[model samples]
Structures are given as C-alpha cells and as structure tokens.
Target: MKGTIHKCLAALVKEEYGEDAWKKCLQSSGFEPERNFALTEDIEEENSINLIVESAKVLDIPLKKLFDQFGVYWCCTYAPKHYSFWYVGMKDAKAFIIKLDEIHGLVGKHFNNAKPPRFLYHWTDKNQKVLKVEYQSNRKLIDLYISLVNGLAIYFKEEIEINKISEHEVELTFDY
Candidate 1:
C-alpha cells in the first residue's frame, strides 16, 4: 500500500509539477530527495513525514509557508475506485476539515459508491503536537497518504499511524 501510494504521488507530481521542479522543491525544503535511512535528509518511512512535522513544530511555521518557500502548488484527481490526492496546510484545522468534508461529498456524489471516510489533520496531545488523518477503502488509500507527503513539503513534518486495531479504525501520531 505504501509503495503504491508513493508511486501514485510520484506520478501525480510529475504530471503536475514536472520531475525536475518537484525534485528541486523537495531539496529546497530540506528533504534529501534521495533514499537514505538515518539522517534528517533521508525520508525513511518511519522517520519521513514525522521528521518534517517535528521541524515545523519547533520552528513555529505552517506547512503551506514551507511549500511556498519552495515555489510549488498542486492538484490531483480521484478516479474510479481510487482517490488520488490529499493536502495539508498549517493553520486552521477547521477549514481543512471543511474542505475534506466537501471532498467527501464531491467524491461520493460522483462515484455513486461511497467509500469510507479518510481524514488528515493536526492535533495537540498533552501539549505536544501530532498530525494525523485516516481513510479506508478497496484501493490503497493513496489520496490521504500522498496528501501527507505533499503536506510535508508544506508542513515540513512527519506523521505515523500509531494504532490500527481494526479494519476501520486508525490512530496516528504526528511529529510537527
């Protein structure tokens, strides 16, 4: 599932931002843009999104500002049996939730077969910040995950699903 989401995000960004432009954006935003496991430059799965999110928390910056620093914007489509994009901004969790609800309605109305709802957002836990969201469906749940990666460019952050005790329930912890 993770690999598929990675591929989908790659494809979409290539289509939207161009490969070279996207790579430059990632680099300028302080991501390695390469595969390495043990450094902040590397985005190994466990450390990938959470690392960036934590940086944002420390610096008191919004994800969108980070992406803006890199000169990028994005758009994607949800297709048959597959939802294609997710994005996160730093401020106003409420507005973001409204947008997600609007997306859910749009996709549900268009597809005629509503999949389960998936959410992505930041929250505070015990005076510490965590970013998270969830989606469940037949396809790989790529939309939210890809949005998460893109969100990292903006949020400069990382997040993880700390618990998934059932098919329908997920608990995530973010580090930004």
Candidate 2:
C-alpha cells in the first residue's frame, strides 16, 4: 500500500476522531507513534491492515465503514487537496475514473516502490450508460472500491447506480 493512502486515513481519523486516537492507531499499527509518512513511500501491507484494525477499535466503528469512508475521503477530499497535480488534466470524475490505470502506471513510473491496484473498464451497455469495472487487487477491498466509485460520482454530481457483479467486479449505470 502507498503511504499517501495511510496518511489520508490517518488524517481522517485525526480530523474526525481525535489526535490521540490517531496516535494510538499508529502505535498499534506498528508504525512509529509520531511518524510522518511520505507521499510516495510504500507502506507495509501488514502495517496498513493493522492500522485499519486499530482504527476500527479506537473509533468504535466497523472496519467496513472505515474502509469505505476512507475511500470516499481519499477521492473526494484528500486527493483533490494534496494531489491536485496528479489530477491536472483529469478534472471530472469520469475522466479520472477511466484513466485510473494510466494514472497508476504513471505513479509506478515515478515511484518504483508503489504498488497500485489494477483497474479495467468495460463498457457493458453503451446506450444506457452502464459500465463494468474490474478491480483487481490482492487486498480484499471491494467495499472500498464501491465507495470510491460512489464518491467519484458524487464529486461530479452524477446520479449513478452501482451493482456488485462479483467480489472483484462492479457495474455502474448512469446517464452520460
């Protein structure tokens, strides 16, 4: 996982829960108590999982909600605010959505250690504005992916209908 993901989640926990809760989450997640994660650095997957678990325990919320909400925050707020350069030409949600693989490819080029997820877009129903998204990741984060898609739709203020086709795939329907 990338440090930027962890950093934004940490920020969410701190901003919503409290600074101490975030500190505790970091400590329990096997990261340094006051460590500042670099944006391009690679975070250990195990540590990132630990942080999610610890954050759930501290915030008294289910891990699913945490993951989903973090996904929402990532695309809507954090990425827009801190990583605006990445979205330079990809202003709208659909533009960014379709180019996710390209974006990840670029990130991989700039940061050798980055391991981003693979996104494959398939237009299932061209007339009805239905599209199938294939999210392939070692991490079982279908919920996060769903929320992330919804967040992106919301960012563009698009009314979308999403259906989970499988554990690793989803279908999005909307007006183009």
Candidate 3:
C-alpha cells in the first residue's frame, strides 16, 4: 500500500477521533507512530491492514465501517492532492467509476507496484439506471469498494441506493 494512504488515514483519524488514537494505531501496527507519512513511501500491505483493524477496535466501530469511511475520505479528500486530474470535469458517479481502471493505469505509470484492482461496470437491468460492479483484487477490500460507490454518488450529488450482493459484486440503483 502507498504510505500516502496511511498518511491520509492518520489525518482522518486525528480529525474524527484524536491524535492519541492515531498514534496508538500506528504503534499497534509496528509503525513508528509518526503522525505524518511521506506520500511516495511504500509500506507492507499487512501493516496498513493492521492499522485499520486496530483503529476500528479503538474507535469502537465495526471494521467494515472503518473501511467504508476511509474509502470516502480517500476519494473525496486524499486523491485530490495527488490525482486531481481524475476528478476534473467528472459530472457523475458512473463516469467517475468507469474511469477507475484507466486512472489506476495512470497511477501505475508513476508509482511502481501500484497493484490497483480491476473494476468492470455493467448494467444488471436494461433501464441503465441500475449498475453492477465486478470488483477483483487480491486485497479484496470489498467494503471499501462499496463505500467508494456511495461516496462517488455523494460527490456527484446523486441519490443512489447500493446493494452488496456478494463479496465480489455490488448492485447500485441510482434514484436520479
């Protein structure tokens, strides 16, 4: 995982919970307990997962909630700092999501070992308002993917209902 993700997560935790909590989670993950991490640095994936899990336990929230919330924060806040090009002229959630694979490809161009997931978007119903996402990744952070879908809806100012049909698929029905 990118250290920038960890950095943004730390900032989010400090903003929502407290500085002490962030430090504690860092320590629990065998990190240096630094409040700020370099954006270009890379850390072991297991450490990042450990940090999230430990943070959830300390915050008394479900692990899924933490993952979902982090996804929102990452998309709405963190990515803007490093990849604002992807957000430019994005007028809708579906359009934003459809570009994910391309965006990850772009990221991989700059960042080695990007290892971003593959997202296939298809319409489950002919109405076109219903969208299904096929998420495939070794990390398998499905909750984050689900929350990212919801967060994009919020970003595009759309009211949408999301249903997680399984570990690898999500169905979304946009009310707009």
Candidate 4:
C-alpha cells in the first residue's frame, strides 16, 4: 500500500471527524497520533488495514460507510487537488474509468514497490452504455472500488447503476 492512501485517510478523518478523533484512531491503531505518512512512501498493508479498521471504530461508523466516504473524498476532493495532471482532458467518468489501469501503471513507476490494483474493461452493451469492470488485485478491496466508482459518477455528474457480479467483478450500467 502507498503512504498516499494513509495520508488521504488521515486527511479525511481529520477534516470530517476533527483532529481529536483522528488522534484517537491513531492511538487505538497503535500508531503515534503525530505520525505523518509521506505521499511516496510505501506503507505496510497490515498497518493500512489496521488504521482503517481502527478509524471506523473510533469514529463510530461502519466499515462500509467509512470506505464509501473515503472513496468519494479521494476521488472528488483529494486526488483532484493533489494529482490534477491525471484529470487533464478527462471529459467524463467513463473516460477516467477506462484509463485507470494505464494511470496506475504510470503511478506505480514513480513509487518503490508499488502494486496498485489493475482494471480490465469490457463493453457489455451494443450501445456502449454498459461496462463490466474486472478488478484484479490481491488485496480484495472490492467494496472500496465500488464506492470509488460511485464517487467517479458523482465527480462527472453522471448516474450509474452498479451490479456486483462476483467478489472481483462489477457490471456498470451508465445512464448518460
């Protein structure tokens, strides 16, 4: 996992739940409250999961809700501000979703031991309005991925209907 994830999670927590709540989450997760994760640093997967789990407990929110909130915040707020170059000329959610694998590949090259999730795209309808996205990753963060897709819909002002095909696949029907 990249420290950028941790940094974004921290930012989301602090902004929505206040500094004290974030500190409590950190301490409960067995981390120093003042610990700062560098954007390019590689964070241990266990630590990342622990932080998220602890944050949900500390914030009194369900794990799914936390993931949902974080996904939206990352897509619409954090990433746009910090990685604006990635969004250059992106006209819609579909374009951005299709470019995810390429973007991850490019981003992985800049980090040490980066293993970002990869996406496989398939157009399921003749009209090209339906998409089936296969998420290939060992981490199995499918719920987060789904929420991120929802966030992309919000970001592009598009309505989407998502159906989970399996643990690793989702079929998206776009209403454009």
Clashes of each: 18, 0, 0, 0
Off by over 4 Å in 1: 1-102, 110-117, 120-128, 142-176
Q: Which candidate, 1 or 3, would have the higher TM-score against the true structure?
A: 3
lDDT per residue as tens, model 3, 1-176: 87777887887898888988888888877777765687877878888778878888878899878877787787777787677887889878877878887886776788887677788889877778888888888887888888777767766778778888888888878764
- State each model's CA lDDT, in order: 0.42, 0.81, 0.80, 0.91
Q: Residue 70's C-alpha lDDT in candidate 3?
A: 80
> Residue-wise lDDT of candidate 4 within 1-176, one digit each (tens)?
88888899999999999999999999999889899888888778898889998899999999999999998999999999989998999999988999999988887787778899999999977888999999999988988999998889899989989899998999999875
Q: How accurate is candidate 2 locally (lDDT)?
A: 0.81
**C-alpha lDDT of residue 14 in model 2:** 84
Best by TM-score: 4
Best by lDDT: 4
Q: List the candidates' TM-scores in order.
A: 0.31, 0.90, 0.90, 0.97
lDDT (Cα, tens digit) per residue for candidate 2, span 63-136: 87887778778877998899778767765666777888888778878887777778888887747477888888
> Per-residue alpha-carbon lDDT of model 1 for 58-163, expressed as tens digits?
3456754533332223222322124333443424333443366467656556553344355544454764444344554554434333443444334433343355
User: Of 2 and 4, which scores higher on lDDT?
Assistant: 4
